[model samples]
Target chain A: MIKRTISSIALALGLAVATIPALASEGEGLAPAGTNIRDQASLQRGAKLFFNYCVGCHSLKYVRYSRLASDLGLSEEEVMTNLNFTGAKFGEPVISHMPADDAKTWFGKDPPDLSLEARAKGVDFIFNYLNSFYLDPTRPVGWNNTVFPNASMPNPLWELQGLQTAVHGEAAPGQEAVVEKLQISTPGRMSPEEFRGATRDLTAFLEYAAEPAALERQSIGVWVILFLAGLTFLLYLLKHEYWKDVHESH
Target chain B: MANVFSRIGDWVNERAPNLAPTYRKHMTEYFAPKNFNLWYYFGSLALLVLVNQIVTGIFLTMNYKTSALEAFNSVEYIMRDVEWGWLIRYMHSTGASLFFVVVFLHMFRGIMYGSFKRPRELVWILGMLIFLVLMAEAFMGYVLPWGNMSFWGAKVIISLFGTIPYIGGSLVEWIMGDFLPADATLNRFFALHVIALPLVLLLLVVLHLAALHEVGSNNPDGVDVKHGPKGNKWNPEKPIDAIPFHPYYTVKDLVGVGFFLTIAAFIIFFAPTFGGWFLEHDNFTPANNLVTPSHIKPSWYFTPFYAILRMIPSFFGTAIWGVIGMFGAILLLALLPWIDKGEVRSVRYRGLGFRIALGVLVFSFLALGLVGAGVTAEVIPEWFPGADVTTWENAFGRLMVLGYFGFFVFVWVYTRFGFEKTKPVPERVTMHD
Candidate 1:
């Protein structure tokens, strides 16, 4: 009875655990963010973009600019020259000098620290939200978002994304101004595809920023699981040897 | 090396009198049926995780901030500033989920084998108490983080006490020790999480073991090994086909431990957040008093009960039925030994009604857990027909809440009334299929 139940349960447990990876939080018209946190080059591009644009308002206070340098395969000199817009020290956190009160006055609210934003709002949400921005003349920021409606922050990458006009259709009969999609009217230096790649890279960087050790830990976890597998093999042999006496004697 | 260990043992025995005897009784000579199998592993695996949680928890407490102001930052500080603190934090956080997973499995093993029957009733009761304390400990530990979920989850859960009509408001205020969930609640929860609950857990674990040891084990066959006659002179004290736990089960459990650690390490290192099941996405943000997140889902472990809590319609004076249903759900599990009246202990020999009931119960529990975690049931669409998604979802949830309680009620009814032929249990532990 014990043997049958155990074998059955172990089999079921294996199948149940196998299903977890498939449980991606897919919903609505949200695009899949295939973020590759281990891709250092993509992460580097993301870091560059984040520091250049987002840092003017938002901050990554948990992350050291110097640590970012090493993790993204850049030297202190290169980081100092390129990404250090606000003149932060190499060892200091990636915080901008823009004061909160002043920023609040400008944007109607202080832009939250993006240190844990990727984790808090999720990578897909961030990836989608950035791309969901559209032109809305009546709004204070002159922009609205499909992902986050009435967001206070303007489309900071509007120059690259150009002007996106919101195409609307009724979800039901009475609903007005329900956006169906976005279309770029006047394109900027970067095309839509290039902007998507940039956002993906930014998403990847935020994924890394949320937990910088994720890439390293994922790499090390393979070895750790493998080592445990080795120990499991040895113990299996030991168990079979011990159980031999009981089986033969019986 | 062997002689030196014996000498040290003898030296210790001289001072500590009967140390060897105690060790023999608890470890070396403790005998169990040779037919014990995989599910037996989780008992020891649970112990392994408890040790991991306690050790990791102690280290975390050394650095953890008790006040709401620094709690979120303190976690970040530990993650970044302290050496290997990220690993420790992941281990503890990840271990909390793993602990429940293993405990749930262990309890399932009990249900599968009827380990809660007859002479083992006290063991079941003690195990139930341990589970209760464990839930409290996990809740308090979660609050220590002071994240969005931490603060709000505490507020929402503690506010359940306020459902008591006359005394409810004061009780919640007393529990929080302030107008809302603030530093005082955080500090008190910290004390209980670190100091009080762990002591209860330790005591209950000891008692659980003692009760089980006294009763020997209920094997998969649901037969007591100590029945009939003792074994031959070569193995005089133990019953037929029984083996010592130390060399046999200990080694067997070690392989299980290896597998468990493999799974745990994978999560802790690769997906500690487990895509927001083990660690919720909302927990990444510091607690904000003014704004609540769009949705407040409990951790995956609590989802089933959380579902039960939500199943009750507000028309039943809002909170009263939900609170009653939530507590009663757990209380049913605790009272199962007396409630279940099946002639046979193991499900292997249980009646047809029992088999079907068990299947539904497991399904309902898992379905409820998923639904609780904001996963909609696919079956609901087919059954409900015309209603909007959320309405159907709530209706399905209500149906599940009914099935969940109906399972316990069925156990009580089936055990008392159902008739089924019992399988002829063997006298000795036999390996042959």
Candidate 2:
């Protein structure tokens, strides 16, 4: 009967483990994100870049500027001097002064707030999107993306990445030219490898923005498991003393 | 100090003579059959899990936000800012999953030994009521996170009420307290999850134990140790086959609890989400009313019935029948005490037909659950994975759902003809070896 119960427990545990199944990735053109959320230095650099460029248009409504000090390991004074652009208070949400209605009319739509964007679109999607922009003659901004077709926003990092041109394949009959590949027509100050690293940093920062506790959770988890192990050993000895009769009789 | 404690004890004893007697009756003197098996461990463990949930749940409410707008961020806040909040949240979430696992095994024990058989019918009924309340409690609690899955899972379930022809739309509106599931829905669910269902659940659990104590425990042998002719058969004052639950079973139960906690710690600390089984990845994203996820699955515990709900073709015109089918799967368990016509109690005494049916039922139920978790989730889910069995999955799902119902029918058939076969019931308790 103990064997039956043991086997049953094993079977249930097996089934419980089976429950998650493997996850299938969603979304297209999502190049694998090569960023680690644990990379604090990269995240700090990403915050600097975000303050310089993305904050002028896109706002991170959910993040607090104050949180960056503790999370990204920046000093409050450093954050104020380096990253604070709108002269806001330390505890304020990362909001931009650009009015939504005016920006919407100017750009065909207001630049969406990016508080939950990293989570909404995965890290891979954001990473690839940063690298996918290219020049298109017919578009309003003279820019387009293979990742996101006819994107209204011009290349936000075009200067750092330089201008990219889509090399097209021969058209089939009346069809439009298929962009077979991308080429950097004009090189920016940063090399392709450097730009990739920069984008990786940005992706890491966004990933942390999505779940700031990701790094600490697993580390703290080790101690929690250890504590439970100690408790189990204490309980087991007490239980052993009580079960002396049952084992002897059986 | 001893004299003072004795005076207080005397004062309590004078006020209530039944206190010590009741304690002795239920705890010290309760005569459980000595040959009880490892399957008996879960009943107390279930109680332990229940206590863990209630305690952790109370702490969670201190920090949790009940509004849909703030709920998602608030969970993250708890996970991040609150002291040891992640640990508490994990314990609660993991406790919910463990609660079902513990209860299911306890239920299986009852089935194996026919604990639901004669003289203990009320205990079974009360237990069944507790199970129903637990489902409701879990359902309400699942929505409190207010993530994409929580919002949409609640939406899909509440929309089931809207399937009721004329009053359906109004019923759903009234339940939601708005046009759709939003702040009002989250708030109401919060109240019910924390207060109403738990209140009823505690009461039912109490009743379940009280009723169980009145009849004493059924053992693996399914023999009544309480009654028999003294000296000639078995003692009436104290059955020779029975042992006191306190020193014997209490210690045994503690060991079970230790094992349970070890497994629970493994889940809570290491895999809090249980790899998307306990917590879905979609739930990490905040709820969006405008966009629907391509695939929506219920929490792992509820998936078996959800699969049944989806498997039924809605050719009967309205979806009301499918809704009925989903609920009927659970409601059928309440009838188990009366459904089986078998004279014998233990599965050991039952013929092969009954065992075969029991085996199939377990298989079908598990198959349905595995399928519902998203077909063959055990395998890696790549789009072009070679094991893709999209069509086969649908067919397999349909068959398993049918087999779930067929098991009960098979029970009705086997009980009619099958006669008991077992080694003679010993007058004194005997070990299997």
Candidate 3:
């Protein structure tokens, strides 16, 4: 019974460990964002895009300008010169210039801070939501999202990605038509491939903004594991040496 | 140098003479059974995790805001602005989950080795009290972050108290100090999580170790080491199969600590969220009382009991039955030392009836954990297309709950009657490589 129990436990533990990486990539039937925070160039590009487009109404309130400067390999001067459009200090968080009342008047609700959006909803949700925007006359805003159904705000980067229209599926007797696919009606500044890459970069930046420690965590984790492994090996030797008395006793 | 240290030690010892003897009693002279196996690692590991929690908790409290409005942002502040604050926060969060993991394994070891039997029953009772207190601590600590899940989870759990017969509604209101889990609830939970419960937990741990030492440690063989052949290297009165805890087990436990810390560090650094099990995704959002999370569940550790509460149907227009069943499940486990009446201490010498009974209990517990975590809810629909998910889940979950309680009844009847066959009892502890 003991042996069987131990083996069963071992099997359970093994299965759990195997599922960790698989779970990290889980998303809700959306195209994978495939964002890498380690890619400094992509993160920098995403940071620029966020400041130029998203930062007018939305804020990354938990993210500091100095942190962006350091993690994205840009200098304080560079960040202030290019990305600090709100006239905040270098150490202050990235707040939008738009007032909450003004935002509520414009969008019918205040746009939420995007500081933890990539975490609350995964990077894939952000990427797919950005890409899923389509022109809809039925909504209060001129745009609608297939991923989010009826989001309050219009597409902040609509000019860059151009105008998209929904391809509706066949409706049942009393049901509304489902968005089967999204098609670009008019091309914007960037082509289909470029827009995808741009969205991917923006997704990567938001992912980093969500947890800035992630960049440092992965690098430091390697060294921490190595040090503990060394300590464990030495302790194993010491334990082995001390247990000889018990082995020799009988 | 040695002479000066000895004189300093002597001066302190003269002032507090019992301290040296007490230290010797628990450390250098305490004789633990030499045949202890892999399961023995968890007790010391649990102590290590407790220290981890306390130290990290202190640092977290230094920056953590107690109000509902600032609590979420303060945690983010800790992660972003404070120097090495992310590490401290991760350690505490990871430590909370790992504490339950280590403790559950420790309790399982006690059951497997029959360490809760006979003279060690007080030790088991003290340990159970610690377990109960730890659950309260973990639940309260989880709500301190003031995330959407934390707010909803607190509201859901505190409302469970509202199922009492007469004062249920008032009781919940009293517990929360408001109609809902608001600033008042957060403040009180912070106080209890930080100050009150930890003190109780510490006292229980000391008493548990004291009681265990009074009766001595139990081994895998479940043979009474004190009743065996006498005379070891240091003490003639001690059993032949016993060894001092200081150099033997202390060094042994050190190795276990090293290995345990390695895994802990891996999780803390690489996967602090443990794929949303340790930290839920919805918890990233600040608490909004107006909007609740789409899919709300408690932490993974509470799922089995949570599943039980959901599985049992409420009767007589009151949900109190499910509440009673949830609390009853934990009560029955705590009453295990008195439940099994079998004379055999080790499963090695126990009959097939007891073995099967224990097997049923373990299997059912794991299955119920799955049900509680909503793993079966997602999987059942995928595995059997067009199946009614609620009906299927409830049927499977209800059976598992029965098996969970039935183990207690089965073991008691099987042993109370002379249905159990016996094997020859060993005179001394036996070691396996």
Candidate 4:
């Protein structure tokens, strides 16, 4: 009886383990479908959004002002005068305006660096999340997110994008449903389409900021692969020529 | 004119086959039975987890400062200031634990199926190397936040290497490149943990998979397939044996990858730092060498070994023994094929001795792990009269340590003399038809 119990338990455990791989294959979230985010113009707009909105709270500490200026085709003087804070030089990093302790105390969370934000949370997630914010007065920030719940940070771009609320209602029997459509309660500077475009640019900029080398690396990779392929072809031809004489002689 | 056009078409077809073989040929060529079911997925999952770690880690490193003063603050900066920085940090931190879980499963699979057997020795050895490198990576990564546990945990683990006879002190110094696990050690380890070791791991993983594909896979049955279908009772049809790697394995892997990500995401977004084991409260405190943390422990993965190490009495020699036992556990696995001499590969046909030995081995490990976590009972008080330790507790601890070592010896003996010789093979076979 003990042996049978043990065998049964083992079999059950084995079946569970076997099912893991099958169950694992579902719902890849928020990575854009079939889109390569390599357009230079898109990256440029993304940089502009990052500087205007994101730099106030989040710092790209690893990225120097000079590097950003050169990469994004901005003048060092423009970067220093417009974007630079914390009395940092042109070669210095984009440090946050808020002190760590104070930020933590005020927001109940410290603001993180934006440098690698894009690489960490893919561009689509950022894009969708920025647009997903809806009003919730109960939360610490007076704002809630569909993508991220109970977010401590308020919608910083609310002035430009305007206040939008989600309408909640019940679904039919045996269904789980909560539908949300943005209804502007208060108007801001930009229209909805324009606001979305701005957010897209911001997300793109953050993505570029996260891995500034990605664009260069990808382009370089293409050339390198091409060169290697050509070399392989040459080697193959050489092998054929060399082997032909041996086969004929034999 | 029609014949010339047809000839041209035929020429294109002949060359096209070379460029891209028919689905059937391609399937036969590459999709040949990995025969690998559960165990095979973990390595690939480990790779996916590694990539996740790297991506998340790079972002965290961007904002993270290694300086003693700013290290803790910078990490906080990432959580708050950077847009979605919190998400990235959680993903990377959670990924470190997940990496170990997958690798452990992968290594255990290697053991259970005798994937480490003879010709595939290099695969197992490389895996051990990867495991060691992973440990180092996790250790270095823990120290990056410069939290309370990070500082003291490094101190304790580093202190372990200081147990050798004459050159012990020097060896520790050499390993750290300093007197202690200080700023220089953190910096170099950060470099190694992020860049150097990952590259090596990637290369080793590729080699590990290549070796696996070459040998096909050892199933739970463990039958050698070289002797044709007559020797083995089960035979997978040629078409089933040959599935295209691109669509079939790729889709399968993607599904597995998706599921792994979902679990990881749920943990990262929902419940990062599930209390004591995942994220210790003390780790939130900044690193302070002046003040030693109370009851410093390594991450959950290392707890079992750490528990074993602490069970030893001497503060000095105990550390050395811990290191030996940890490495010995892995090194012993490399020699398992030679150690177990049963002619039949499957555990199904194995004798009572093997089963009992396996059970005991598992139990001993679990007991050692429990003791390592410092779960001691106060049953008897006479073991150390002067000291604050109880007799039963002390004896239990010592017994578990012995049991841990005894498992290897038990398996070695059982495989040598306890098993019977195989009987003659059955000739007749019945098919489903």
Q: What is the C-alpha lDDT of each candidate?
A: 0.84, 0.81, 0.90, 0.66
Q: Is the docking of candidate 1 incorrect, acceptable, medium or high quality?
A: medium
* Each candidate's fnat: 0.61, 0.43, 0.70, 0.00
Candidate 2 vs candidate 3, DockQ winner? 3
lDDT of 4: 0.66
Worst 10 residues of 4 chain B by lDDT: B424-433
Candidate 1's displacement at residue B30, Å, is 0.8
Error of 2 at B37 (Å): 4.3
DockQ, all candidates in order: 0.56, 0.35, 0.62, 0.02
Per-residue lDDT for B227-294 in model 2, tens only?
Answer: 74332122247776676788677877877787788778778766776756777767877788986866
Ranking by DockQ: 3, 1, 2, 4
Q: Lowest-scoring 10 consecutive residues by lDDT in candidate 2 chain B? A: B227-236
Whole-model lDDT for model 1 versus the true structure?
0.84
Please give, for residues A1-250, the per-residue lDDT of candidate 4 as tens digits: 3355347447644643443332121113443422234766666676666777777778887677887787777887777876665678887777877888898988897887766555444466677788878898777878987766677887888988999787766877898446455578888899988888778777777766755554454454455445555654555455455434323421
Give the per-residue lDDT of model 2 (tens digit) for A122-167. 6888898889999998998799999889899888898899999999
The segments of candidate 1 whose C-alpha lies over 4 angstroms from its true place after superposition are: A1-23, A170-174, B1-4, B232-234, B314-318, B377-386, B418-421
Please state the CAPRI-style docking class of candidate 4: incorrect
Poorly placed runs, candidate 2 (over 4 Å): A19-21, A24-35, A106-155, A162-193, B35-38, B227-236, B376-391, B419-433
Encode model 4's per-residue lDDT on B72-185: one tens digit a residue.
778867764576676688778888888987887777666665667766777777788788878888988888888877988888888787776688888889877787667887
